[model samples]
Target: MAANAISPVAARWIRAWLILLGLLVYATILVGGATRLTDSGLSITEWQPVKGALPPLDEASWLAEFDKYRETTQYKLQNHGMSLAEFQFIYWWEWGHRQLGRFIGLVAVIGLAVFAARRWLGGGLGWKLLGLVALGGLQGAIGWWMVASGMGDTDRVSVAPYRLMTHFSLALLILCVITWLWLSLRGAPRAAAPEGRRTSILLLALVFMQMAAGALVAGLDAGRSYNDWPLMAGELVPSHYIQGDLGIRSLFEGRAATQFNHRVLAYVLWGLSLWAAWRYWGGALARPFAVLAALVSAQALWGILTLLNAAPLTLALVHQGLGVIVTLAAVYLVWRAAAPATPSPVQE
Candidate 1:
C-alpha cells in the first residue's frame, strides 16, 4: 500500500461511520419535518449551544421556557391559549431534533479524533472528515437562523420560506456528499459512462431542486391550502396566485402559487424518471433507474394524498421521508454512472 493511503480496514471503518452519520442526518430531517408540521420549531426561543442540551428538568424550568415561548409572535397570535402540557409536547419534539443534531456532531468529532489519533485516516480522509464537521457546525447556525426568523414580534407565523429552504437544502447537500464519499470508498474504481453520467447528474440536480420547492411548500404551510388533485383551487392553474406587483415573487411567497409550482415540478420529475427508466433499460443501471422511477412515482402519489388530507402528520412525515429516499436513489444512479468500470472482487 502507498505510505499516505488509508488502510483497507481503516477505510472500511471510516465509511461505516460516515454511512451512520448520513443516516442520522436523514433522521434529523424527518424530525425537522415533524417539528415544522406540528408547529413546534419555535417552542424554545433561545439557542443555547452547550447549556440547551438539558431540556427543562422541572416545573420551574418548564415554566421559564414556556414564558419565553409565550412572548413569540406565533404563540401570541396562533397558540395563545395553549396549555403547559401542550407546550411540553411540542417542546420535546424541537428538543429531540436539536439533540439529534448535537449527537451527530459529537459522533463525527469523536470518530475523527479516534481515527486521527490512531493514524487510521490517510489519503485526505482526515480532511474530508474535518470538512464534514465544519459543515455540521454551519448547519447548526443555520438551524437557529431559520428558527429566529420566525420569532420576531412582527414576523410571520413560521420561518421565512427562503431560510427554510436554505436549511433543508444544506442538509440534503451534506447528506449527498457523505453518501457519495461512502460509496466512493466502497469496492473499486470503474469506468464512467459519459452519456449516462450526464443524464444521471441532471436527474440528481432536478431531484434537489424539487426538494427545495417542496421545502417552500412546507415552509409556507401551502400543502394544506389546496386539497385537490390535477387542478388547484378548481382550475388547471390558480387564478389568485399573484397578490402583489411581483408575480414572479408569488411562487415563493404565495401559498397557492407555491403549491402549484410544487405540483408541476412533481409532474415534470415523474416524467423524467420514466424516461430514465426507459433509457437505462437492460443496462447495469436498470435496477437503480427503476427504483428511482418507483420512488418518485410513489412520492408524487404521497404528496397528492398529503395535500388532499391536509398534510396529516403521519402521511406528511412519510411524504417528507420519501424525498430523502428518492434523492439517494438518484444519487446512487449518478455514482454508478460516474464510477470507473474496473471489475473488483469486492463489488457490492
Candidate 2:
C-alpha cells in the first residue's frame, strides 16, 4: 500500500488483459442491443463463420442479399420498399455486432496465451478464462439462433423474447464473472455480508431480476407504445393488459403488461435502493448503497425519457445502458458486502 506504483509483474499483465477482455465483451453486447432495436439483426440470412467475413465484393452480391431480406416479414410488412441505401444502414449494424464478436474471440485467445506462457494462470484459474471463452463461442451460436427465429416468423420480424432474455442474461453473467475475477486479482476478497448486509444482497438480486424483466419488455416493443407512466392507462394494473390476452399473452407475447410491469418495477427498485441507502447510512455497506441509490434514480429518469420519446434509438440505448450500470453497481455493492471483513491490527 505504498504511494509508488506496484511493479508490472506477470500477474498484472494477465489482470489487465482480462479486464480489457471483459470490457470488450460487454461493449459488444451493448452494440448488439442497439442492433436489435434498429431492426437490423436479421439483415443477413445466412450465418457464415468464414464466408461472412468478406462482405459483398460486388453489386450483384449486395442485390442478392437485399432481395433475400425483402422476402422476409421484416422487409415485406415492416420495412416495405426500404431503399437499398437504407437497407445498408441496418445491415451494417448487425454486421458490426458479428464483427465485434469475432474480434473479442481473437483477443481473448491472444491474452490467454500470454497468461499461460508466463505461467500466470494455473490451477483452474486458466480454465475459468477458458470457460468464459467457450461461453463467448456458444454465445455466437445462440446469437444466430435468435436471429433465425425472426427470419421467417409470420407475425414477428424480431427474435423471441425468451431468446433475447437468454442472450442478455448470458452477457450479464459473463460480466459478473469478469468483475469477480478482476476484484480477486486486485486482492480484494469481498467483505462478508454484514449482519444486515444479506438483506441488501437480496435486494440487489431482486433489482437485477427486474432488469432481465425489463429486457423482455423492451424486446416486445412494450415500451414504445406505452406512453403513460406513474400508472398504466390511468389504473394501478391496467386489467385489460393482463386479461386482454387472457392466459396466452402472460409471458413473452404480452406487450401491454410487459411495459406496464417494467414501469412499476422501476419504481419499486428505485424505492428499495433509496430506502436502503437512507436506512443504512451508518452501516457497513453504506457507500455502495448510496451509489446504487444514485444510479437507480438516474436510470428511472432515463426510463421515463425513453418512454416519452417513444423509445427512439438514442434514448432507448441510453436507457438500457444505464439499467445495466445500475444493476452492476448493485451487484458490486452486494459482492462487497459479502466479502470477508478485514481484522484490526495486532495490539500485543
Candidate 3:
C-alpha cells in the first residue's frame, strides 16, 4: 500500500499465492502423516469429488461400508471388530487430507484466472503458471496412485515406499519453485554473490536429496526400526541392514540396516553443511549459510528425537513439516548464489 512499494505485479502475486499454497501443502502432509499413524488412509477407498461429500447418509449405508472394511486384512488382524466411533476417528484425518487438497486446487484455479485477466503477469510468467497448474493436477493423480498401492494389496494396506517418497518430493519441488519466484519478485536477488559462494547451490542440491531419503524413511516406516543412538544396532555402523537386499528394494526394506543408511546420510549431510557454513562465515555467503546450517541442525535433532520416541504422530509430523521449511530456506540460498546467463556484447 505504500508508494514505491510497487503493487505486486500479477507474477509476484501468483508467486506469493504459491508460497501460501506451499504452506497448505505441508499442513496437508502433516495430516497425511496422521492418517497413516491412525491407519485411516484407505477409509474412503474411492475418489469422489462430488459424491464423496455425502458420507453414508443412513445407517444402512454406513454398515454396508463398515462391512467392506471388515473384509480387509487390517480390520481382521489389527482392528478386529473396531467400533463405528473408532472408524470415524481415522476416517476424518484421511478425509481432511483429501479435502485440503481440493481446497489447494480451487485456489490455484482462481488465482490463475484473476492474474491472467489483469495482464499483470508478463514474459515467461504466463507459461510457467500453466506448467505449475499442470503439475498441481498431476499431484492429484499421484495421490491416488499412492492410495491404489494399498487398496489392491493384502500384505499391506499402506502406500508403497517409492510412491510415498515421490509424492513428498513433488510437494517440495513445488514449494521450492514458488519460493524462488517470490524472492525474484521481491528484489531479493544478490547484486553479486561473493566469489566461491557457488558451492552453496551444490549444497542445496545435496540437502534436497537428503530430504528425499528422509521421506523414504517415513514411507517405509523405517524410523521405528533404528532406535539406537550414536551407533546403530550396537555397532558404530550396523552392517546388517545394507547387506540383506540388492538394488533399490534394499533401500525401501523396513530393516535396521536401511534405516542406518539414512542415519549416516544425515550425519554426512550435517558435516558437509557445517563446513559450508564455516566457508560462508568469512565471506559474503556467511549469513545465508549460517542460517541454513542452523535450520538443518535443528531439523537433524528433531529427526533423532522422533526415532528415539518411536515416531509418535506429533513428533513425526513436525519433523516432516520442518523438512519443507528448511529445504525452502536452502533453495533461497542457492538462488542467490547461482548467476543467470545474461546478454553477450560484440565489438565492431
Candidate 4:
C-alpha cells in the first residue's frame, strides 16, 4: 500500500462507526415519530441543549416544567384540562426523543475525534465527517424551530406542517449520507450502466419526495381522517380536498388535501419502481431494482393499513420504519448503479 494511502483496517473501523451512528439516527427518527404521534412534541416548550438533558428531578421541578407547558397554545386550546400525570407521560416522550439526539451527537463527536487522533481519516474523510457533525447541529436547531411553532401565541395546536416536513426531511438526508459513506468504504466498485444509473437516481428522488409528503401528512394528522383507501370518504377524491380560501397552502394545511397528495404520490412511486425494475431486468442492476420494487409494494400496503387504523402508534411507527428501510435501499441502489463496471473474465 502507498505510504499516504488510508489503512484498510482504519477504513473498516470507520465504516463500522458510521453504521452504528446510522442506527442511532434511525432510532432518534422513530422516537421523534412517536413523539409527534402522541402529541408530545410540544410538551418540552423549551430548548436547553445541555441543561435539558436532566429531566425533572423532584415534584417541584416537574411542576415547574408542567406549568411552562400549560402556557403553550397546545395546552391552552387542546389539553386545557390535562392532569399532572398525563403531562408527565408526554413529557417523558419528548425528553426521550431529545435524549436520543444528544446521545447521537456525542457518539459522532467521539468517533470523529478518535479517528482524527489516530490519523485514520485520510483521503478527505475527516472533512466529510465534520460536515455531518455540522448538519446534526443545524438539525437540532431546526427541531427547536419546529417545536416553537406550536408554543407561540397562536391558535395552532401543533407545529407548522412545513417546518415539521423540513425537520423530518433533514433527518432522512443525514441517514442517507451515512449510508452512502458506508457503501463507499466497501471494496473496489463495479461499473454501472448509465441508463440504469439515471433511473435509480430518479427513483431515489421520488422516494424522498414521497417521504416529505408523508411528513406533511403526519404533521397535519391527515392519515387519521382518510381512513378509507382507494377512495377517501367513498369518493375518488375527498369532497373537501381544497379548503375555502387557503388556495395553494391548502395542500399542506388541509388534512384531506395532504392525505390525498400522499396517496397519489405513493401510487406514482409504486408504479415507477415496478417500471424501473422491469427496465433493468436481467442486468447488473436487476437485484437492487427488484428489491426496491418489492419494498415499495410492501410500504404502500402497510401505509394503507395504517390509514385504515387511524395511524395508531404501533402501525404508524412501523410504517415510518419501513419508509426508512426503503430509503436506505434506494440509497444503496443509487450507489451500486454509479460504480464502475468490472471487466468480464477474459474468454478462452
Give the best candidate by lDDT: 4
- Among the numbered candidates, top TM-score falls to 4
Count of steric clashes across candidates, in order:
5, 6, 1, 4
Q: Lowest-scoring 10 consecutive residues by lDDT in candidate 1?
A: 339-348
Give the CA lDDT, 0 to 100, for residue 189 in model 3.
Answer: 35
Give the per-residue lDDT digits (tens) of candidate 3, residues 1-348: 322233344435666787787777777778877877777877777778766666777778877777777776667777887898787787778779888888888888888888778765554566767787778888888988887777655677567778887887887787777676666665443555746456776677777888788777777777777687877768886666554445456767556655776787778878888888887687767788888889889999998899898888889888878877788878878766767442111110
Full ranking by TM-score: 4, 1, 2, 3
TM-score of each: 0.95, 0.90, 0.89, 0.96
Candidate 4 clashes between residue pairs 3 or more apart in a chain or in different chains: 190-340, 190-341, 191-340, 191-341
What lDDT would each prediction earn against the true structure? 0.88, 0.76, 0.74, 0.90
What order do candidates take by lDDT, descending?
Answer: 4, 1, 2, 3
Q: Could you list the CA RMSD of all candidates, in the order they appear? A: 2.3, 4.4, 4.6, 3.5
**Cα lDDT over the full model 3:** 0.74
lDDT (Cα) of model 1: 0.88
For candidate 1, write residues 1-348 as lDDT tens digits.
Answer: 555666678778888999899989999999999999999998989999899999988999999999999999999889999999999999999999999999999998999899999997666667877898899999999999999998876657778898999999999999998997788677566556566788788889889999999999999888888888878878998888886775778878889888888888889899999998998888878888899999999999888888899998999999989999999998888988885543332323
How many residue pairs of model 1 clash at the backbone?
5
- Candidate 4 C-alpha lDDT tens digits along 46-130: 8999999999999999999999999998998899999999999999999999999999999999999999999887666788899
